[model samples]
Target: MANRLQHETSPYLLQHADNPVDWYPWGEEALEAARTQDKPILLSIGYAACHWCHVMERESFENPDIAALMNQHFINIKVDREERPDLDTVYMAAAQMMTGQGGWPLTIFLMPDGKPFYAGTYFPPEDRSGMPGFPRVLLAVAEAYRNRRADLERAANDIQGHLTEHFRWSLPETAITPALLNEAASGLARQFDEANGGFGGAPKFPPPMALEFLLRYRLRTGSDTALRIVELTLERMARGGIHDQVGGGFHRYAVDATWLVPHFEKMLYDNALLARLYTLTYQATGHPFYAATALDTIEYVLREMTSPDGGFYSTQDADSEGEEGKFYVWTPEELEAVLGPEQAPIVARYYGVHPGGNFEGKSILHVPEAPESVAAAFDLTIDELVEIIGPAREKLYAARAQRVWPGRDEKILTDWNGLMLRALAQAAIALGRSDLRDAAVRNATFLHTHLYRDGRLLHSYKDGEAKITGYLADYASLIAGLLALYEATFDVRWIAWARDLTDRAIADFWDNEGGAFFDTSADDAPLVARPKDAFDSATPSGNSLMAESLLRLGLLLGEDDYRQRAMTVLERFAALAAKAPTGFGQLLCAADLALAEAHEIALVGDPQVPAMAEMLAVVQQPYLPHQVVALRHPDQDGEDEVIPLLAGRTARDGQPTAYVCRNYACRQPVTTAHDLAAELGMAVE
Candidate 1:
């Protein structure tokens, strides 16, 4: 039978519709019912693509006996964390406080007013492996509520106080200098897995932001060690099973440090951040491998995760046909059947597919050897091997498509789409793909039309419905995407839109007392704590992304307040960022911008003319991460007056012109790409 979750929009909530447990979506009705009946609430929080979330649902939520116990004893509620991050933030802090650990499928027993007294993650149906069973835990909690009411209240109050305190932080008096960035670089390098590629031990997640920091560091200080770390990590990941070598995109974090095995759920944010990282690496190093990898990841998103409305979807499930990695893994016989006998052996040798298999008696294809080594083993040239492997791999991909595919979470989230938006917008210029540029333009319009309302942004969209008030990350990330689009095409309106959203973010989420941004706005529903997380986890933090956005806007628009606030954020986190820089990658990147020499570029003329196009391409190429470029078209006539960088700029004798400036002082308006490249400190043919 369907429960109350049948009517909810989140696919994660709708997944529990047929569970025997009666579930109410978190709202006033459920809170009111818990208060009126004098019963505690059993709150379960998880997302659509969480593998353990599915495991707990089948083991406990589907049990009729367990459902009966929950129905009689509590006002049971279910929440999709992606839809309501504010609630998730408040409770995640509480769960970490009580249990000393936290992950998805978060289980918490709370009082009616929403203060958590008890919290945990996944629990099995029967007690095993030193973990308590769900049934026993439920019974004991119910008993305590009735017999030891005062004890439960006391515990809740104590935990609530600490949880609130955890989110409260003070901005310190400090100075941000180049030394902080150097110290952070060393701090992050101290943990680098010299044997393996990434930073930590087991459970290796891709450190795109941290690698981005290394790239910036290389450009800033010309450190070969920084550049080597970035190159080695990217290469190792591409050769691992964590990267989908057959298809495209990367899986979730690998369970082992070798990156040989992954959890298998592919998230949009991971690919977006990785794609952008690879593109920037290519621009910085002039490497063909980085460019190829970036294109593959973007193609995967466009093929599998895009919505008809042009927004990117959220996640691809790890499990298919009730088994994790079932659809992705390949047996030796399956490979032989998919590819002919003539090609199977050669392909197997190339992808390191062995008869014993790397996973559960099935191969998760990974490149264990370089093309030169594999080609030597097969007595074929590298070009010959590539020619044969490309078509054969596509045949296998097509055959894999015939299997029962993994489930996809179809919701289009504003924050994730913004991440992908920047990737596509940047790729349009970096890769010189007109299709991606068209896609980026269309997606920007889609987001502006559907997600942005009045001056505010909405959080999630699905089936033509956009709901939920946008959070700080959503606003800041979208502003980032808009800024990228503006630079990719030199469309002034995109920058104008970004400036407007930046103002809105400041008005809504900034805290005057703390001198930083809160994760949620004051007008949003009250919780045990208003979260203001600063560390970068799976995704970049809102405060860090916003800091970069502010710095860019400050340079582009000459806004003193924006620059001042950005510097304040950098100073506030300087001490901690210098200690454990891996967790503060994005913030440190913003700090790099704060201390680096400023490059403010202005290009004036029609972009279609040969001279203008050449000059524009010169600006677009190369990394130059800290530069801010503005284009003023001759046809627009006063349309670019909003951009201070273009002020008093002219098309030198009616030809295309380029100006490279610092602190509002301009160089000669050069009319050629060579002269422009010289002004920008680059070598061009």
Candidate 2:
């Protein structure tokens, strides 16, 4: 029989609907059941794409005997971490505190109330490698709960106290400064693995936030070391198996130091963040590789992950056909079959495919030879080689289409879509891609139409249904995207929407006294404790994003209140951020903005005019991290609709004029693109 999860919206929950163990989606019903029955609640948190989650389900949850033991002793509840980040955050903290580590397929034994007493990650059905088996652990926990109720209750209470205390951080009064920024860069530089391109040892995750920080640091200080680190890391990652050669986009992370092997799951957030990082790298260094990679990654999203209504889907599963990476891996024989013998050898050699496969007797294609080297070895020109490889790649992709693809979690998450929207918007402006701009607008429109209703945003949307109240991350990230969209198109509507959203966020998620946004809102499902996310993890923290959104939006809207709140939040976390620079990459990026001697460029003209377009292009040309640009056109003529920066601006001699300002102090307006470039520190092309 199907469990309660049969009616649920989450793909993860639906995936486990037919498990032998009777599973309840995390809610009041399960909590009440546990309380009334006087049994502990076993909460298992995992996302749909988690490979180990599927493993545990097959081994333990599907077993009738094990299900009987679980059903008798505990109220089993499953949570899709992507849906309820509040629950996941609270319990993940407890798991980390208890086990000194935390990961997906998180197992927590809770009392009738939601306080976790015991926690762990994946457990095998049978005992192995010194880890307790799931059945044995379950029996022992149930016994302890029965025999030692008072003691277990006391321990649970203590754990709750510890978890609550974890969110209470000491606010240090420190100013953000360039010296501190340099210190943070220096700290990251020390941790950079010189042998490999990433930081620290094996199992390297792509640190997009850290890489972004390094890029900004290099831009500010003109440090070759910082630039080199960013360049090498990006180049190595693209060349490694962590990046898909036939397909585009990257896997979750590389499992080895050399980036030769990856975990193989594709997540929307990682690709979104990395695409923006790559786009910025291209703008900064004029590297063709970064531009090509960024475009390819964006194309991957457009092709595979996007929904018909324009919302980006969440994740692609790591496993297919009960085996990890089966769909993505290729044998030399298979390659030859797809590309004929003559072409197969060269293509295989170029992509590191050898007789002895790199991964489980099948090769994972990655760039192993340089274009120049491969071209020379093949006795062909570079253009000739690329021409041949291009057709060959298309053929391989078409053939690979015949394989069963990984399961896609088709939920549209507001925060994740916001990340991708920002990437698309910014990349459109940077790369002059009208198609990307149209897609960004479509995505924003989808969110505005479907997710945002009655001045409130919904967290997750699926099958034309929007569920879950928006979190701080949702508001903050979407506001950031809106701001990026405004910059990309210079549309005041996006900025106005961003302003309204920021105001609502302040009212909903802001801790006026504490000076940072909480992960959960006042109306969110009440948990053991509300968390203030301070670190940049798999995605950026809500607090850091809120800070950044306020900083950028405040400048564009001329809102002092938003800017002040942003400063307060930054100052509150300044000492902690300074102490742990590597962990606070997004916060550091915000600090970089807060401390920058920023420029406000108000371009007054019709956007369609040739001269005005040239001026706008110049302003967008250089990678100006600290400049905020706004457009005042004849079309937006209403008094109330005018932004503060563009209020008094006028076109000089009926030509498009640029008013460049430092902290609102304006210089004389310039008409020509050359003159505007001079004022804005860009070399005229």
Candidate 3:
């Protein structure tokens, strides 16, 4: 029989709906059931793409004996961590507090009133290798709850107190300066593994945020070391098995420091961030490698992750057909079958596909040799080699398509979609790709129509239904995307929508007393404590993104209030950011903007002018990290909305003119791109 989770929209929850164990979706009903029955809640939290989540579910949740034990002893509750990050955040913190580490599938034993007395990650069905089995832990927890109630209560109280204590910040404020950024750069340099081209040892996650910080630091201070760090890390990852060479996009973190073996799951957030990072690096250095990688990543998202309605899907699972990485790995025999013997060796040599594969007798394709070296060995030019490899890759991709593809979680998350949307919009401008612009606009339309309700936004959507109140991440990231969309298309409606969302977010999630945005809104369901995340993890923190959005929108809208709020957030988090600038990359970005020379480019003329393209091209060309551009068409009437940056700006001598303003001081308007570049201190090509 199906459990209560059958009705849930989260794919993770729906996956367990028919489990022999009766599972309740987290809600008032489940809470009431625990309270009424006086039984501890067995809360299991995991996401759809988590491989261990599937393992635990198959081994324990679906087993009849264990299901009977769970049903008789506890109120079983299942939660999709991706769908309800608020619950995940609060409980994950508690889990870490009690166990000293935390991961999913997160197992927690909660008291009747919703306090967790015990917490752990995955547990096997039977005790093995000194680890207690799930059944053993279950029996012990139930026994403890029944016989040693006071002890359990005391532990829960202590855990709750520690959770509260963790959120409070007491570090003294340090003024953000050039030296602090240098310190961050130096810190990253020390942590960097020069030989492997990543930070630290095994299990290497791509440091997209850290790379972003390094890029900005290089741009700001002309630090060659910082630029080298960014270059080496990106190039290493691009050539490593972590990147999908036959297809496009990257797998999740590499298990080895050399980036040779990845975890196999592809997340929307990681790709979105890495794509934008690559694009920015390309713009900053005019590097073809970065641009190509960015384009390929974007194409991968378009092909596999995009929804028919335009929103991006959540994730692609790590495992397929009950085997991890089965869908991605390839044997040399399979490669030869697809490419034939003659062409197979050349492609194999280039992609490191040996008979004894790098991963469990099946190759994860990667560039072990340089393209020039491979070309030299093949007695062909690099370009000629690439031409042959391209078609061969397509043939292999087609053959791989015949295999059982990995499961996809089609749930559209507002935060991840927002990040992707922002990436596409920014890449569209930098690469001048119309397709990317269209996709960004279409995605914005999807968010506007499906995820947004009457004057508010929902967090996740799937199968034509939107549910859950929007979190700070949803509001901040979506507004950031909308702001970028406005910049890309010069459509004021997007700017208007961004403003509206920002205002609503401030009302709903802003901590008036604490001075940073909360992860959950004030009116959200009560947890052990409200989450006010400040540090960036796999995704940028909501509070950090909120601060950045406010700053950019405030500058673009010429609203002092928004800027003031942003300053307050920066001030509140400055000390924490200074303590570890790399972890607070988003906040560091906002601080960089706050401290840099604020430049606004107001192009006063008809956007349709023949010269407008050249002027806009120049604006897009310079990697001006702190500049905001707004179009002020001369045809605007009183009825049309006006942005502050565009106010009192008009064309010079009846022609399209560009005004470069620094720190609110406008320079003489220039009619030509070259002249405008000179005014902005950019060398015209």
TM-scores, each model vs. reference: 0.98, 0.98, 0.98
* Cα lDDT tens digits for candidate 3, 1-685: 8999899888999999999988999999999999999999999999989999999999999999999999999999999999999999989999988889999999999998888889999999999899899999999999998999999999999888887777755445566676666676778889888987878899899888888888888888888988898899999999999999978998989999999899999999999999999999999999899999999999999999999989999999999999989998887788899999988989999999888898998899999988999999989998899898999999999999999999999999999999999999999999998899999999999999999998899999999999999999999899989888987988888988898999999999877876778888888888888888888878999988988888888778777889888888788787667667658878878877888787888887776677988899888855778889999767765313557777777778888999898655798889998898888787767
What tens-digit string does per-residue lDDT give for candidate 2 at 523-606? 877788888888888899888988988888777767888888888888888667766876888988999999888888899888
- The residue pairs in collision within model 1 are none
Q: Could you give candidate 1's per-residue lDDT for residues 415-488 as a string of tens digits?
A: 99999999998888888788998788888888999999978999999878899889999988898998899888
The TM-score of predicted model 3 comes to 0.98
Off by over 4 Å in 3: 636-640
Q: Please report how far candidate 1 places residue 559 from its true position, in Å.
A: 0.9
- Ten contiguous residues minimizing lDDT sum, candidate 1: 164-173
The window of 10 residues in a row where model 2 has the poorest summed lDDT is 634-643
What would you estimate as the lDDT of candidate 3? 0.89
